[model samples]
Target chain A: MSSIDIAYIESDANPKVKRWKRLALEPRAVKRERATLLEGLHLLSVVLEHPKAEIAALILSEEAVSEAHELVEKLAERTGARVYGLTKRLYDQISPVENGAGCMCEMAIPAAAAPEDWREADVLYLDGVQDAGNVGTLIRTAVAAGFATIAANVGTASIWSPKVLRAGMGAHLAAHFVENLSPETFREHYRGRIYAADARGGRDLFAAPDYADGPCAWVMGAEGPGVSEAAIAVCDARYYIPIESSVESLNVGAAAAVCLFDARRRRLLKHG
Target chain B: MSSIDIAYIESDANPKVKRWKRLALEPRAVKRERATLLEGLHLLSVVLEHPKAEIAALILSEEAVSEAHELVEKLAERTGARVYGLTKRLYDQISPVENGAGCMCEMAIPAAAAPEDWREADVLYLDGVQDAGNVGTLIRTAVAAGFATIAANVGTASIWSPKVLRAGMGAHLAAHFVENLSPETFREHYRGRIYAADARGGRDLFAAPDYADGPCAWVMGAEGPGVSEAAIAVCDARYYIPIESSVESLNVGAAAAVCLFDARRRRLLKHG
Candidate 1:
């Protein structure tokens, strides 16, 4: 506690405060800084334990400084990051969620280089998925199901966006993510089976024979149009989750969970 | 179009406007009136197709009436539901979303009676899942996986709340829901096997032998504390999704999807 230095910020106009507000609200700021804001102590604690984490600052609401004083001191000491205590109003301005845990941090987004050959990578590919919650949930689900890499096309939402990060529930700290990818690039580099999540026509996912336990990519698309034409052009086949014929389709997040965990289940049954 | 009468309501203080506003914002009003509001044309279209649907009114923004006039007229005629054209400002007041389709309706809550015996039922029991989105996604996933019944414990978020309804994406119209059930009642009435979604420890879900294709229930709980004690008391077994050991847990919605869909997969494999 004695070693932790806490800077108290009273004004929204302070340079640090303004920059943080921008980082929280504006994607451009996050890109320029190569960092993003992670709200809540839960995310902060997860990031601190990641081997590659580089935390720039920890911001705590004035109330949190008192309510979570011991834990805050421990986190500050562990990361040796600068700590700022903000007025509740100022903190609220930087947090997108209403009535959130009054703690957040700015963490340097780890630069994960894509493998020169994606032929042997088990990947989750996002094609034009723009919902932050969906993208975040997919990341979390992919990690849970043992996907090591995630590649998103240019039009997908930023994986590090605040809302996505919140939805990710700390799984962001575990996976290697590559964004701004193109379908042409995916087709050229990935020499493995690629299965698009097709809603309209495909082999029934549960009844289909399992793909060999090797490198594969599960391509998921936006909710409306589903897997894009470009993405479909690269797929070895398309698979559709079986649902009630009257229901429209499974939500993308739910579909991903069903697909990925089924993949895991297959792997477990075969090996164990 | 000639068969439909579109009433224009401009005043926010009109008694009709006030009552509809209360219905949209207050759960008490919804329960009292025995109806809930469904926003967007997609939901309206689905409810119109259901045989039991009784729409009280269809409210549309001025913009939507023009943008979707033909479809609106077709829907109104199909259901013979009263239509009201609201100013964008007033329409936005009733719709919880931003930049929505601007079509909404108050539909009567369909009456569904509990089955005489749960021994032959496949159900999804939500045990104190307080997040509206999680509850909704669970409903959608369960319905997709062919679950016919949903029962939630008393402390779970209201299954029919606007947020939950919006998240359900029309699944609410497809399934029978029984909310505010006590675990004791569930234990007494339901003589089937119940599996709780446990994050901590349980049979590795994928490796566990399948339950026979008969009456069964999957119990899903809140994210933080997992399943409630009461819900656990009624569960014959606990199942946990396998994930990366470093990761904490899967989101409740994702967990439910994995569990329910796996159940579907087992059934498909057995029958096909």
Candidate 2:
């Protein structure tokens, strides 16, 4: 591996080191600074594929410079991004994962304003979905099922948190996100029907009519209390996936996958 | 709350405390000792509903003794189970979660041998799914979709691990589990067709012929190195859930949910 001659930081108290640590660890800092850290080479590569991704810098552990040299060199050349190296100690402190891929990237969080035609497009609205893993998995599912826009209200887990980003598995790069959304604002702007996914006491999903025939939004909520009364009030109807009586309820992520994929399947059959 | 006479242990060095720690922290101890720990009152309540669950003991933090008095006292009375209280410090050391629901129950790990007619029944075969959360979620989904039996090959996560049990959310009590199953043994004994859930290069799941019409097994593999060659060889065909090309793959748990629920939907329609 050829030496890249990149700038290196060793001190824990360095100004840039402190800032990067904050970005990695603090959600408040991530929001206030309007930047986030993407852990590992895989997430870096995925973000690079997006044309609008504003990659600010690439940071690597000293070991990664030698181990993942080829991909690092290629990524640096393609994006002309500034590169920095840190001692393993500093890298480990900042990384959410221990002994992770040993590479990290800093980039602006993707925030696309709800489009003028957003009301006529399909959307997935997260209502107080608190778990980072569930929030991330839901975003990944929405994108794969062809929901281009995701709206998360105030009580939901922060989309760009390190844990959520790790769980998202690079789906953040492929989709547009709207955060701190309010159900009231959604009701005002979105013209299509809004459906809440209930844990129980709703129309059976398969037996329900195809609401995917037009612009629509699926409101998924937290597991225990389920969709808030306020969120449910904004919906046109509530639908539930059927399961055996013995099982209490499906995990929120699993429920979202079933609802979204079933909609996609029906839409595909209808259009074909 | 009336004072319930119960044995209290303050010392961490006690044999029961040491053993409980092993069961909570070590998979080997759980497997060898044939016992597992369930965290929280909700899980304990769910297990109590299962008629066959043998409640060996109930342990509560001093805080829970007052906070959850009625339920704890009733549980002790109902099963005539041994009840013990641990100092908060001692309880925290033995529990998997921090500031968790303070009540815990110990029970024999459910291990029902595959039935005599297992070959004629539908099953979910987990092929080397290593993530504890994924393993637990898949089991929950399997039971909800009415798949009575779950078979996991040796490489998969232990179904009774604390993480798996928490993620399974008491689904383990409702479903039968067969662990350390070999693919060769499965191939020999199970007469039903086996379909693997492939990430790519397979017939479209929606367009594929209705295999759910008969007894079958769905082999779901790990996220990266999908179904092993040995396991794939045992399958009759593979079916890929059609997804947008931009996303790499669905999380294994999500993939399993889609496949199992689709089968359930078809079967429900066929009979109805």
Candidate 3:
């Protein structure tokens, strides 16, 4: 193991502190640097488990180091990552959660493959779903349902944003993510049957027996506008989750959970 | 219709403003007054549609009045609700959403039915589900799935709170809500097959063909602790949603969606 020499940062104005704050708050900075910030111990632990995860820096508050000295030390030893300690006040400035775990990691963003290079995978395509929490919950739901990949179009929330990351609850580590793709590019490059989720004018999802035992993609639209005309045109079929007419529609996140898990249920019944 | 005399309040210290603020922010005030605040145009429209809805006061920003004069006038005419206008600054203080709809309503909290008084109804029992957003989402999901009643234990978030009201997206209008009931009382009074949602040690929900075509209750627990032992003990059975082993579990709201919709799907199939 490399010699343990931890740098201590005391000021919010420090360059490292500035960079961390930018990464936590600004999506552009994350994209520009090709790095994302993982906050709290749960996310850090998940990132560590991934074989491709590359830790650029490991930052801990003084309190975090005091509270979890052994775990922090072991992580640093295992990854040989450069470690930095921040004063409590400085740490609070960069922490996104109200009661943060006081540990954060700056890690390289995972590379995305071109549509042409996409492998046979169960993919979730998010089109214009802008709510960060919804996006994150969908990602978590996707992972739980055994989806292998997530591809989000331009209007969707950045998958690496801090809000989405927190909502994802470490599910990002288990799935491949591709972002900022256009509908045209996605259709041209992806080699899968695409099913669009629509509220009206679609077959009942529960009764639809056409979900083949092969690679497929489920395209979800934005909260209100739903999938664009262009995106809808490329889909192989449209499916709707039945609901009571008294309510207008289900929340996108809830809708995603029902659909994704239903697909999983079908697969298990067919394969098992 | 009574002559429209919209009283305008400019000062934050005004009694009406103080009361609205209290109703919006303080749970104790809401419970004491047996009233809750509804914000925005969509909620107001939904509340207006309920024949039993009693609007004690209607508060709108001057901008809202100007922007939606016809709708506001119609609501006042229909409900005969006393209308008050607030300065933009005063309205912003009480508005929960970032883009305040500039309208608010103070309405009676719907009376809850005793467990014995509940008719043949599909019920959702929430035990210690404290997150406001989660509580609201579950209520919406329940309504969409044709559940007729919601019973939340003491530790659950207040069903009438502003945050929950907003997240519910008008589902509250269609469902009877009971709160502060203990597991013992709930079991003694409720008449339905009780199924607890468990992450482990339960029949596969998708494969469980035993869901009788009758009134049933799905008991969901808090985000972290899952269902309490007391709650679980009273349940007739436990059902689990099958998911991948890589992730820990689905979010409570998401889990509710999958389970509730599955029940609905089954009912539709049986009846269709």
Candidate 4:
């Protein structure tokens, strides 16, 4: 590793500390700067490994440098990004998690792909799934299920938000994220069978004939209102998970996993 | 309906307010009191509908009473439980959610079922799935998948904690809960085949044959140190949810959903 020239900041009012705090706390600030805060060793490693990830800066608390010296050095060397050390108090203020690893970085937001970019991808479209945890879990599930791309409509939670990133558990680095698209734009540009997951009044998910003939998009709706009527109208099919009648529905994240994995199961069956 | 006798308390120091706050905020307090605080209209309604639910008190914020007068009237009449009104300040202190529905109830924690109580029930054993959200989501998913009983082994999050209840949505009312069991105790009591969900090195879940012939128990492990070795040793079979090679595994809750729902589908197919 190259000699580390780490600048130390003890004041909370430092401009760099203020910027990092804003990026962690304020979605508007993240958007304005076109950068998001990546926290902890796991997420930072993901960013480092991602071919498209652009690192702006790395910030470490005094405690973090002492605890993870080798990791900090390697990360600093790999990105050739300026490294700053914060007083523990300032680090605590900027850390999104309680007793965080005290290491964080500013990284350029992964550019959202246009509809044309996903033409050959098996896409997962999130329609207003407002819970950040659900959104992140879906991103992770989508990658595990082998979906190549993810699109989030306008009403969906910001995919780059800190809470969503934490819930996503570094899945963001592995999948293509196309954010802030309207349902209409998604309908217009995507050339694939669109399957909307419904709680009721649809063909059974398992009973539906094989869908492995081509790439498809699974449109998951929000918790309560479900897929918006406008989004539903554009779907080629509606699939219902066969849940017992006593309950209203599965949590959106759980529902997404069932659907994505089931599709994968069908694909495996067809090709094997 | 009987005349609504709603009592009002302005002071946060009031005993009733203190008790309610304790129940909402502290799991130990909830256990000692043998009750839990239920928030929002939907969960309150579930408690009201449950045949065995015993209401100790129904607390409504001024905002909630005005916004949901009909619901308040119906609940007040149905339970004959004393209704208390809190000043917005005191209400905010006790409310578990952001923008809470303003109504809550203290309902008796249903007695934990003994091993004998689960004789013919399809059981879901949560083995150290410590995240409260995951625990609650698993409970809701288990119910929707028609699992009649849930057993949380020691190290699992409390099933009736506020976060779990919120995530559960109202699954707590519909399913039987068995808490604080050892892995050996669970094995000794459950009279069915036990299946542990593993990330790898197990039979494909979809290919598992004909479990609908009898009751079965699904053991879901924690997010990190998945199904404890002790717990796995007690299982009759281990099942793996197939996923893309690049990713590690599904979230515990999502994995539980896929497993429980797949069992439900098999049951339906068998009955048909």
> Which candidate has the top score in TM-score?
2
What is each model's TM-score for chain A? 0.95, 0.96, 0.94, 0.95
Backbone clashes in model 2, listed as residue pairs: none
Runs in model 2 deviating more than 4 A are A65-67, B65-67, B115-117
Candidate 3 clashing pairs? Answer: none
Tens digit of per-residue lDDT, candidate 3, span B116-148: 656367889999999999998999999999886
Say which candidate scores most in DockQ.
Answer: 2
Choose 1 or 4, whichever is better by TM-score.
1
Q: Which residue ranges in model 4 land beyond 4 Å of their true spot?
A: A1-3, A65-67, B1-3, B65-67, B207-213
Model 1: per-residue Cα lDDT over B28-52, one tens digit each:
7876778788887677777767867
Tell how far residue A29 is off in model 2, in angstroms.
1.2
Query: CA lDDT of A64 in candidate 1?
Result: 71
Residue lDDT tens for model 4, A3-91? 68889999877898888888878877877788888788778767666656788888888778443555667778887888888888988
Against the true structure, candidate 1 has what lDDT?
A: 0.83
lDDT (tens digit, per residue) of candidate 4 on B1-272: 32578899999788988898898888889878888888888887776677578888888887775545456667778878888988778888888887777888888888888767895689999998888889989999999989969998879988888889999999888899988888898888778889999995788886666655689999999987899999999999999988776567788988988888888777777786
Supply DockQ values for each candidate: 0.80, 0.83, 0.81, 0.72
Residue A171 in model 3: shift from native, Å?
Answer: 0.4
Q: Please give, for residues B1-272, the per-residue lDDT of candidate 2 as tens digits.
A: 54556789999788899999999888889889899898887788887687688888888888774545566677787787888889999899878788876888888886656656478778999999999999999999999998868999999998898889999999989877778888888989898889999986677888777889888899999988989998998899999998888799999888889999999999988897
